[model samples]
Target: MVKEIERAGLPVVHICTVVPISLTVGANRIVPAIAIPYPLGNPELPREEEKALRRRLVEKALRALETPVDGQHVFED
Candidate 1:
């Protein structure tokens, strides 16, 4: 779907736990996530901490969307 969106002339940032899968799917902008079950949050952590983590991930994704890429790129912390 990421490729399809990009093909439509829209940029997409794919947030997933597996970087390889995102690459295989031709995601130009990729953001590494925490886990499969909880990609943006850690339930074991305190509520505030989890929220912070999710916020950071979202921030990174937004940054990825802003940045230009000639090809596949991974936005890592």
Candidate 2:
């Protein structure tokens, strides 16, 4: 799906918590998030904390849209 989306000439940014797994599966571009169970939000965490984490990761993913690269890339903080 990632490749197909990119092949269609659209900018693709894959947000994943388990970054290595996504990369192993051939993700063209990936942004590291929190964790696998909760890529954007962790249920055990307080709502505010989860929201903050999600917001931060989301911002990074969005910035990735403006980043141009020639191949698979990983964004980390």
Give the TM-scores of the predictions, in the order they appear.
0.97, 0.84
lDDT of 1 by residue, 1-77 (tens): 99999999998999999999999989999999999999999999999999999999999999999998999999998
TM-score of 1: 0.97
Residues 11-40, model 2: lDDT tens digits:
889997777777887777799876777778
Model 1: weakest 10-residue lDDT segment is 68-77
TM-score: model 2 vs. ground truth: 0.84
- Candidate 1: count the clashes: 0
> In TM-score terms, which candidate is top?
1
Error of 1 at 11 (Å): 0.8
lDDT for each candidate structure = 0.96, 0.83
